[model samples]
Structures are given as structure tokens and as C-alpha cells.
Target: MIMDLSKQVKIALDYIQSIDVSDIDDTSEAGRIFYEKFIPMAGEEETIYKIENLEVPSFEQTINIRIYRPSNEKELPVVIYFHGGWFNAGGLESHDRPLRKLANLSGAIIISVDYRLAPEYPFPTGLNDCYNALEWIILHAKMLGIDLKRLAIAGDSAGAALATVITRRAIQNNLNKILCQLLVYPVTDASLKTPSWQEFKDGPVLNYEGAVQAWNLYLPNIKEIENPDASPLYSDELSDMPSTLMIIAEYDPLRDEAILYAEKLQKSGVAVKQLLYKGMVHGFFQMGGIIDDGNRAIEETAQFLIQNFNK
Candidate 1:
């Protein structure tokens, strides 16, 4: 379908298209400037009850995490969040606005994890950091005012990919702490050969070339692209995964893989909610400050969280 872009998305696309990324390097100063320029800042939300910054001890280094609470509700459910940026860029500050909004809207505490990025830490390092953070959160749930049984994992793009990996690991270890996963246009397959990849290869936001670049930077070798840990879509088993809410963009190169993964999860008897935003491009979920659809998606996600947490 040739869906027309929403006004805000059109503006976003215009802004993105006008950028000169010819000299940009994904690992250097140019990447930093690009991230700062493109990633929308949501500022602050008045509804948030509290915000805290703390560190979690990981295998080789200390990982920083930001906690956002909507209200003074004790033992609130928690959403562990990982930010996008193709796993090479993005950190706590870049995603702070959405985290706060999520905290307030979902009536759950939001823990934004600042996991290590790629080309430096590489594939499993960031994933390992996320898993370790999950472990720490669960172990110290009480001290953090979190309800162990009401935990959820959430992320956008590469972060969504990491969330899926963490959820899979949690199931394999027989840990039932995670109740649901909120994935926003997740990068589920590293193959980068899907039909959508061909369709949106140039991207309104994320292009196929950029996607490949990210995977190359994240994985140690090309062969690792097929590893289920690196690409959750490659996993043979999807059964027993936590309930899932997947938000996909029709114009995103990663769209098809997200749909395929959701289908797989549903067929595996996992509860799945999928939203395909027509005319939307990748990363729309984080552009709420400019895109109306972004806020709507967030509201839907918050409702999903509240419903699942109540269940």
C-alpha cells in the first residue's frame, strides 16, 4: 500500500533527507553529531514521580541505568528498556524522554539501560550487559521498588533485538520474572535480505546499507549473523517467550522480520500484539515530540503494559 506519510513524519523525512551523511562515520565524531541532531528530545514529563540514576555491576565493567517512576506506587511493575541507534550509538540521555513518558503512561517504573555499544564492545558484550542488568534488577527488585513477577522488557530497533534475546535467555534459564516484551520495530534478523529490506533499502530513516553496517559492527564475524543470540529470528524455539507487543513501521526496512518474529511467537503459543503503522518509517516511536503517531503508539503500549500487569 502506498500510504501517505503523516504531516509530522513528512517533516521528519524532509529533515532526515536534507542531512549530509556522506562523510559520517558510524563510530566516530560524525556519528555523535548525527545522533545528537536526529534523535528527538522529549524533554521532561510532569507526571513522572521520580527519577534516579544508578550503576549496575556487570562482568567486566559497571553499566549505568536510569530509573523512572510514574507515581508513588510501591512494588510497581518495571519495564527494562534498551535504546536503539543500530547498537552503535544511543545511550541513557538520548532515550530519556520516552522512558519518562513510558513510566508515567504505563504506571510502571522504567529502567533505561545504558548497555555497551558496538565496534568496541561488539555483539555479545552489549547483550551480556543487558542480561546482567536484568539479573541485577530481578535480584534487587525489592530495593528498587519493583515487583519481580510483573517485569517487562522493552526496546526500539537494536534495543528491541536485545530485549528479545534477553527474554529468550530468561526463558532458557527458567526465570519467570519477565511477563511481557514491548518491541518497537525490532531488528530481529541479521540476514538483511528480507523483502522489506529491498523495498525500503534507501530508508525514510533506516536504510538497508545502514542496517548491514550496524550488524557488521556488532558481530565479530559475518558467520555470527546466523547466531540465534544475535538474530532472534534464527532461533528454532520461540515457545514460552513472554507475552509480546510488537510495533512495526510499514516503511521500515526491518518491518518484515519484526512481523515474521511476531508470527513465530504467536504460533509458539505466546500471546502477541502487533501494530503496523502505515506510512511510518523506522524510529517513529521515538519521534513523539514531532510525530503525533509516536505518542499514540506510546499510549497503546502503556495500555498493553497495564493490561498485562493486571493479569
Candidate 2:
């Protein structure tokens, strides 16, 4: 049984529920407008030593990537990040404040990808965009002054699924630059059949229907859920994957899937670290303003990434 939510988390969920969106379909034009305008509660912005935005051409369109360098040191370890919004809503701005904190705390260069959203761009499109962007960054690591030897990948929710998929793909192609991966409340299995899925169907933040809807919009073909390409949980090979830090929330619908994935990684000889925030909900890693654990998650993430870089 899940424990009671922390005072801060309860307050945050109450505030979110108070918002009026009775008529706005979250996937419609009005919904996108609302999400674009809804600046997630952000912490004070920190100025990293260097930050720049670049565009990489993808098969679908140009991918926009924001680069954050926390120091002037040459050949710094780097981590590529993908933001989570259930495969549709989040982008650079929605995640800027936390990324800055992550970069500053970690003292490593960060590259955050802005992949295409779904219901329009759909499955392989977003996945391909993320992969192509990483491929381009790897190709230009020297020019970007990054240490390819210490490269890592990180993401949350849908983004985490992408991160692991790419990590596996890299292993398959023998492109072994990714040394570690950090996943925060990752949504790994699309089957939505976990005990947590049944438990948190009416999520404090992420509900079951919304999750299933997002998957449907992102993946039109229902049968694709089994395609390991769509759900990393079904991937046959977890061996040779990078060291992993999986941050899970006890009250989250994705909890069981993430735990199962972490177990799979551990069984396959990959070093896996798991953190279960007792009272937290999905997407709390980016909610620093609302919960202290959010900032703590970033600090822990930085520590893990630094550990991998130092190794």
C-alpha cells in the first residue's frame, strides 16, 4: 500500500486540481495553447556559464537543441536530456529552470533536445528525431568541446523511454559512448497492466486515461505497444546497457513498470540504482517549486552522472 503524500505534494496537487480546464481538450488547439502558456512552477533561474541553441536537421524537420555549459573547462563530460510531457506538451521553456539547476549542480555540459510532439508527429517520428539529434551531437562532439568518453543520456517519463531505447540502439550499433542513463519516473511499459497502473488510475498528477490517450496519440497502431521500439520493457536485450539511475515515485502509475525495468537491467548485469520517493507523484523531478524532493532529485542525478563521468 502507498503511504500518505507529503504535505508539500498534497498542497501541490490541490492547487493543480483547482485550475479550470473544464472545456479545453488537452490535445486540441485550445489545449496546446494552454499548455504553452502554462509555465510550470519554476524555481529561481540560474545562469549557467554558457548556453546556446542550435538546430540539427532531421528526416522530419530541424530539431532544436539547447546546449548548457556550466563551466569553461575544455573536453567536459556531457549529458543529453529529453524533457517529458507525455510525448506532447513539454519543451525547452517548460523545463528550462530545472535544466539550469541540473547543469549548475552537476558541473557538466548539458544538451536538451526539443523533439516533435505527437498526434501529429507520432511514434517513430519523435523517436527518430531524438536519435538523429544524438547522432549529430556525437558526430560533432569534438567541435562542441565535449568529452565523448564520458557521454551520458538522461530523461523523464516518455523521454526516459526514449533514452533507454537509444542506449540499447547505441549498444546494438556498437556506438558505445553512453556511459550512464538517469531516468526520473520513467514510463517504460505501454501495456499499462502494472499493479501501480491499477492503483493510481486516478493519479494525483498523471491519470490512467490520460496516459493511455497519450500513447494512442503518439502510437496510432494499438498493437505497436509490444514492439520494444515503443515499449523498452519488451526489449529482448538489456545486457550491455549503461549504468542506470531510476527515480521512481511510490504513488505514480508508472511505478511498477519502472521498477520492473530496473530489475531487468540488474538481472542483465547492468548496474542499477533505484530511488523511490515515498509520497511523490509522477513528474515531480521538475516540480522543484512545489516539492523539496524535486531539487533533491536533481542533486542526486548530478551526483550519479558525475560518478559515471569520473569512472
Candidate 3:
């Protein structure tokens, strides 16, 4: 039986439900309004480091990147993060608290990337921005006072897809510097017929219709669905990718894809660790103030990154 959510989770879900659903019709207007109004709702407490906006390579646009630096001043690991919004929504501002907590918990520097949204820039554009961010982080590790060899990439939902794709591209280009990847309820495949999609078609937070709309924005066309850059599940290589830590919400629509990706990674001889939190729905990670389970998952993720990368 599914467990009832605690009061905090209930409140968080209430806020989540209050956010307007993205309409595929007016991509920019709906997306902008939803993010401007909704992103700030996720708490962002003042922290030790300064948040700065910077431009990255391979793109003409100036990306918003936040850096949370520890006061200890010692060299720490760097985690480059992307926020979930199905490619059409979400940005650096939306995922502030989660990223801050991750930095605080892991005792690492967290760099959150604000890549371009889709239906405007489309595939490879957002993906490339994230890749450039990775490259920028690696190149400027010294200035950031982070250990370049300990660099990792992480994200939730669609951002998670970007994270995985960046890791694969890093491997293909022989950028051999990435140490790990953290994926939370990631959209691993663009083929919308998975059993999880059927079972959790109307599940809370992220539903089938919302997911399809998001995919349409990211993919922009049918032909791109099979491209590995847009869908990492179709990628021919996984053996050379970094070690992976994937978190899946049992009730999420994307659970099966998360599971299948883990299996494929393991089969391909890549080290993969998966955690399935039962009775949880998609976007639980962002509800830390409401869900005890959300806090627990974040803590587990922090520990996972610190423990593995500390090796």
C-alpha cells in the first residue's frame, strides 16, 4: 500500500499543483510565466558563496551559473548541475535550494547551469550549453578552487537526461576527467510507450501529457528521437561513461526508463548504483521542506557523491 505523505509533503504538493501547467501552444509565454512565478517558490536561503552569472564556450548567450563555495577554502569537488523542466521549463533559479543543500551536505562546490530552454533553441543547443558549462568548469577549476579530477555532473528529470548525455559526450571526446553522474527520475528515452508511462500516466507532479509536451519541446522533430544526443538510451556506447548514481521515485512516470538505463549500464560493464524510493512521486526532491522522504533522498545523494568521489 502507498504511504500517505506527511504534512510538509502535502503542503509542498499543494504548491506544486498550484503552478500552471505548460501549454505547448505558447511555448515562451507559458514557460516564462511558469518559471518566473514558480521557481522562486523553491526556497533559496543565503549561503556562504557568491552566485555569479557567466558566459560559457560554444554559445553566444550568457548562461546563468551559480557557484556555492564552502568557507573552509580547501580544494573541494565540483558538481555541475542542470535543473529539470522537461527542456522547456526550469532554470538556475528554480533549483536553488536543492543545489545549495547538495553543496552544504556534500561539502563540495555546486555549479548550477542555466542552459537555454527548448521550442526556442531546441536539441543540441541546450545539450551543448551544458557541455560547454562542463568544459568551462573543468578549465577554470583552479580559479574556482575545486579539484578538476573530482568533477561530476548531476540533474533531475530532463536535466538528468542532459547530465547523462554530457557524460557520454565527454567520454566520446575522451575528456576522461569526469568522475561521476547523479540522475534523479531522469527521462532516459523519448519513446513514450514504456509501461511506467502507462501505469503512472496521471501521476502527481509529472504526468504523461506534461511529459509528452516537454519531449516535443526538446526533440522538436520526430527524427531527433533516435539521436543519442536527444535520447541517451539509444546511445551505442555506455562502457566508457563515468560511474552512475541513479535515484528513481517508485510512482514516477519515468521509473521504468530509469530502471532500464541502469540495467543497460550494468550490462555494458559500467558501474551503476540505483536507489528506488517506494511511495514517492516525481519531483519529490524539490519538496524537501514537505517530504521527509525527499530530505532522506537528498542526504543519500550527498553521501553517495562524497563517498565515491572522495575515493
True-structure lDDT of candidate 1 = 0.86
What lDDT tens digits, residue by residue, belong to model 1 across residues 48-139? 78899999999966999999988887998999999998888889877777777888888999999999988888989999999999999888
lDDT by residue (tens digit), candidate 2, 1-311: 55588888886777666666667765455545544443565567788898999999999569899999999899999999988888877888877888999989888889999999888889988888988988999899888999989989999999999888888888798875689999988888888999998898988788889888888888899889898978999987998888999999988999999999999999999999999988888878877887899889999999998888887
Would you estimate the TM-scores of all the predictions?
Answer: 0.94, 0.95, 0.91
Q: List the residue pairs that clash in candidate 3.
A: 8-290, 9-290
List the global CA lDDT of all models: 0.86, 0.86, 0.81
- Candidate 3 minimal-lDDT segment of 10 residues: 37-46
Residue 85, model 2, lDDT: 83
lDDT of 3 by residue, 1-311 (tens): 25466566567667867887555567666766665555443455647555566666566656768888755666788888989888888877778877777888888888898898888888888998888888887778777889877888899999999999998888889775789999998888999778989887886667788778878877878988888788778877998888899999887889998898889988899898999987788888886666777778889999989987879
User: What RMSD does model 2 have?
Assistant: 1.7
Clashing residue pairs for model 2: none
Give the residue spans of candidate 1 off by over 4 A. 1-3, 18-27, 41-47
Q: What stretches of model 3 exceed 4 Å from their correct place?
A: 1-9, 20-27, 35-46
Worst 10 residues of 2 by lDDT: 30-39
